[model samples]
Target: MSAMLHPISRRLFLSGAAALGGVVMLHPFAARASANQAHLRLMETTDLHVHVFPYDYYADRPNDTMGLARTAAIIDGIRAEAGNSMLIDNGDFLQGNPMGDYIAYQRGMKDGDMHPIISAMNTLGYECSTLGNHEFNYGLDFMFKVLAGANFPFVCANLTKGSLAANARDDALFIKPYVILDKTITDGAGQDHPIRVGLIGFVPPQIMNWDARHLTGKAMTRDIVKAAEAWVPQMREEGADIVIALSHSGVGPAQYEENLENASLHLAGVDGIDAIVTGHSHLDFPGPKFEGMEGVDNAKGTIGGKPAVMGGFWGSHLGLIDLMLERDGKNWRVSASTSEARPIFERVDRKAKPLVESKAEVEDAARDMHEATLAYVRTAVGKTAAPLHSYFALVADDPSVQIVSQAQTWYIADMLSETEHKDLPVLSAAAPFKAGGRGGPDYYTDVPAGDIAIKNVADLYLYPNTVQAVLVTGAQVKDWLEMSAGIFNQVEPGKADQTLINTEFPSYNFDVIDGVTYRIDLAQPPKYDPKGNLINEGANRIVALEFDGKPIDPEQKFVVASNNYRAGGGGNFPDIGPDKVIFQAPDTNRDVIVRFIVEQGTINPAADANWSFAPVDGATVLFETGPKAKDFIADVKGVAIEAAGDGADGFAQYRITL
Candidate 1:
């Protein structure tokens, strides 16, 4: 058997392995003592994202890091160890990988058809679930059709069918706001007592902006913390012995704000809310990932002084929250609690050691759909003359990003041919989706030269976001690039191996705009912060910005092709929103790439070196990427990267001199 270190586990040592004896493994609940007290174990699988089988449909290979099948093994083991247990999902299960795309686009769910992911969850006997932002990607009608397959109840307090009323209780909810499970818990004395477990769910209210066209008149969302404040009290009033908030949001910022996307920390502070299961940022809690944040007790797995856990995305971890409940005069109250996100695999010397094997029940439930997904992605659309990889995407203009930009430019130019903006110069913005980051050291686009299939295209462009072209002035374009430059750390002229990439900046936000030329001055401070706020307005990192052959005019208007996420203000970019969008297409960006490849017959997707770093005399910086990157080192343009050494975990180190 081959044991490979997945890119996702490459960073596990820093966040999980070392802290957990080289494995983030946990046994079942083991802390109840008295006859009046009972241990109720809660298991959570968040952001499954249709990864039911132990397979990566994009790579068309087995992956140990993700899959509900593997997670079920942990669930069964945990359930056996605890006297009382319940399993619920924290949303983001409907769609993610190629299997989801196959079901939604090709298989077409009928009224009674069982979605593969739902089938697996049903096999595992999931008690309840909630919604994530991606649930609305295929439209409301399609989402409902797929939801019909779920055997468990779905709850969401914030998502509503229409406009809000004066009071949240009067609003027309899209689904049941909450569900109370009436179960019996066995105490240490073997006494059986009735218990009511209340579970309420919340999705990011920003879904209104991300999926606006699909939800305009039919659906709306309320603020997350605000909704929880209104509903937790109601749940307690309805005789909920314990209240759990299934928040499909991230843990961030302790303070409350209206429509804050990552509000789980504040949501935990709501009175009557006993525990929480968080997701949406695809990160783990109770690990080093959430450590340093205020009001977050990472060592104790508590946020807002209440037990909480965030299972890593794509079925990588199982969130466990064990509450020690004591009978309070015929009712139950949580006395003590502990939480942790136990990973399915751990990293040791750059190799993966799977903690749990795939349970056959879940694998069997999703087997048929998995095979169909394989067939769907195997069909070739076109051929590529050169290999497409994203190993150095964060440090250079990459072909993987270039191909996407080319395809978007082609699609948007044709769309504008018959419009009033036909004369405007069309520019396309794209970023590397599969660049090695949190996904792991093995996570990079590596499509060999030759036939380009649906899988390859999917690898290059991961999201199902629709294409949108925004009309912005040249000055705004400069600002966009300046924002992208924020991903790099400032390098001093005489520095040696100073880290080049900012570990916190996501690769998807590092937009490289095609149809323009620019020089990034690394010596200058970044103009925009990671969240796209202009912190240093006078910092001019983007220098010699040009379009066509002349210096770009601040007043000149141009059509910039991008995805709905950017046009809809998903990334918080300054001066980039729906108001600047001149064209929005129903077609997805992935489909656009397929069509463009088909039209070209054999596409050559080599980087053109349109962008480069402005030399800061003798400055050198280092970064870590996939080990496979060494094979394509000679192909990267403009930057001369040499092997520095092996980095921590499984990543390879490379240095670039300016």
Candidate 2:
């Protein structure tokens, strides 16, 4: 057997005399022995979002909770046990945290100098990676530049380049459909056996909606299932033995009506896909069994009788899928498989402190980069007079969201001041970017009243979304909010509903236009398309739309403030298109938010009584919450908590009422 890796054996020497004294070390040999018995070990790091070093760029602190550093430690440990192991990332790698922004904006990615993510990834020796939708947040050119730094092949079957020349250029380094890995594995008899492993990658087709501007003419995306159908057979024809689908997509049941919207389950059923590795919803799939159907041997971690896994995001967990293969007269067949999503570090407190110590070599490799990244992110960008928080976003008008709305409005007003349509009223729509979920409880942005740094700006707007303002009629504006209201499910007047809204709906997509006052009648169904078209029979949910205390004029054209993605039809909302786009600002939303704070010097973005729940005065609604929110329950009037209950992903829940 190969030597085992001890990921947490580094000595934590105290300052002074203790530093020279003999150190106490935890033996990792036992852990290594346990893992070595597996035939083949597969490791996954998903939703890295450009967090190269373990440090949190947004907080400008040593965030032991997230970072590829800890994942590297786990990978090293696993590799020590099983000499033959593969490391793969499930995507969303390009944009999310501040390091991504720093590299994109400050240190422009060049051909040679390693992009931070690529730099760290190269150190860890990643085998291959797929594209997540967020990778398109930056334009294709920028994406190409950043990807150039990676040493491994970038695989995705759905995306296609425009010209044959471009396609040829991309095909050289960027693999279309998949790539085949010919590896040698050692058997119990200490003999080396050759294995042909084929890996196919897929991204959601919704990239067309999420990044239309960048992809419109330069590239195109196909549906995941269609892409798989076309490419998997090609991989099989290439004489590959085992086929694994690395889906930067996610798993969900077939919603007959919204079939094409999410493609995980549909893609899983595609022929030629032996095993599945999924991501992009930031979900953790400890095993192959999804949503109750269990033909998959999750204990073996196989999908459709093959091994599969999906690692949790932000370096929180490292997905380990072990497979046992039986020799089939010169080929190998899967005998058994098991999957587990293991956390690199456990949380010891509310501050996201790390409980498990990192391996010395991994820590040493990342220490300098982590410190430098932290120092770079901590430089003050501006200041704020109040503690910005997203605590009230889901329930009512929130100051954090108000600041974003203000930034959008201010930015759009300047950009539209000289346009021919300058006379039109300008309204801004912004959502809570830092609302907590997969990011954990402390994920919410809460910058105290003081000097706000670049890190703080990142916490405010996690993505590097550019600012865009679009011209639309009052009716279209109403339609936009109506689409946003789809996040909430209709609740009966006195029903004991435990869920408040589909938590699956991303908080950033739930735009709350600050200049408009509109009541969302929960009884009605969503009237607009995710692509912004009006469904004729859809319910009129945004009742009594008003601007500045008066009913909105249907024919009146107004400029609506939004991020570049939405103004470019990212959310599939109505009447928001490039044609209706009157202004496209160069500044990112994070920059605008920071500038707004600096210009105000002191901000009081308190919510005005513009909109409220209609006559739910006596009705109660059950809502789930995190442990961190327990302190804020007093702020919600007439709210009550039932006995505390377990929520998804280790979150705590409480029932509340109006």
Candidate 3:
């Protein structure tokens, strides 16, 4: 592999890893190769989120489906067959797992300290990278300290910083807006030639809104398309042959929205771009998952007439874009392109088998930091009287979310005590982040009864969203619950053995509000869509809502403690927006839960059973949860989840009777 690679090689460290050999191109663009031609393979790993090992730090177990170490092997596997290759990360490498938290909070990133993920990436030999929204989770100072340890250049055309206030100038960029690489590569005909490859990067402008604490008055963002239009032309004027966009954004609507979070599709429409490496959505492009989408040719891997690819998140897949280039008057133009994601493990008959082994060198690079992270996460934070689990989070009142709700409410109560809203009732809303869904059955959280560690807190709450409190009227609260009810499929009163959960509604969107009691009537349609738009204005799934034994008043205002995402219009719930946000806590929800556990010492991990489905005669619905849920069936308070059978992917099928 090293012999075939150029000096600017992609997989120098991958010594003996075997490529899967089968290259399935979901979308193939036709290429007319000429005598003077070269093949450049662009490899991308997006949303790594600090996953360097095939290990789940939250679960404290070795997982088969994640890690950059494993993806490094695949990079070795594929780069051996290509003439020239360049490795790039599309962003979100900083914060996700317990390792990230440990590095940020436990072991501070000082002047000389190296982040484990960056160390692993440096070992893998990444050419360039970009920033994701989560990069700012711990604050800018920490983010920059971590970035300083990276061996590769990090670029983002949209994210800019200046001594001056917010502006739209590309010159104000904190990092280089774009990097031009001068490289010599071997062509398909075994001839050496020089090529100037322009690499420009972009991040979602929503980072300002998402990470307001870190970005306010310090950094500003421009629209992705605007950044691309401004910078791609400049890169060309600097004598670049081809421009590749390291778009740390997701593929979404074709039509451009100024400062849109997911703007990769529209960014590709910008002239002067050859190809795009997209991320931030945690989905694979050119896969059937994106089939039949507007302005996207999934089969051809082209968005807006340009080759594009989005590698799956957490280093699950390495995005491969093979471009066929022909020399045209001392410049190279792409004649054809093909893109696909190569997974570390392949699933056959719903069972995953390892396709590539973890590169020992990469693993060795991260071993020291990995051990420290494990020790940090394993430190006992508190104790749980009952099991801190989420296997039954969707079907019943979950102890996992309950503890988070308790923590948020506890934190917000003190924050509001001196304020005018102190007299008003406080409600906390939390969601089950690990409930079985597209992540499959093993995705559910199951923290055993005993000492609870910081790792357990991560399992209880997966996101890094900070605590936020919003003031809303009773009517708005009802509407919020109605929006949450969209997680369920409308069930006929007399139906039997019907699927009840709406697979489209993410488990994280199913907010369980504490302090107020309500019942979800499954027979009625959801008042709001999953995105929180009022679809059926008159529909009300929240049959009965009461506070302190009294029915909720539409005019009365109450403060609901929740995450920043929810208060910042994430769920699009009615009367919930940045304007309505009354309090913004600096601590992340995960930290709040940790603090709550510490303060309590020995905490009761029990849901109060404040919410449940309204009983309907002769109604039976089927749902699936992690197989571990069977052990705690008797502990569920409100819902009757009778074990029906063993479900696919190691799930336990349950029949809910009403």
Model 2, 339-430: lDDT tens digits are 77877665555566553455445455435545665666677655665566775566666667777888888877776665587788888888
Evaluated against the true structure, the overall lDDT of model 1 is 0.85
Residue 335 in model 1: lDDT = 84
Whichever of 2 and 3 has more TM-score, that candidate is 3
Give candidate 3 misplaced runs (Cα > 4 Å). Answer: 1-17, 21-34, 163-170, 383-398, 407-450, 457-512, 519-544, 547-550, 553-658
Q: What is the TM-score of each candidate against the true structure?
A: 0.71, 0.62, 0.74
Cα RMSD, model 2: 11.7
Of candidate 1, the 10-residue stretch with the lowest lDDT total is 1-10
Inter-residue clash pairs, candidate 3:
27-299, 27-300
Q: Model 3: per-residue lDDT, tens digit, 565-612?
A: 999888787878989988766457887787688889999968889999
Highest lDDT model number? 1
**Candidate 3 residue 164 C-alpha distance from true site, Å:** 7.5
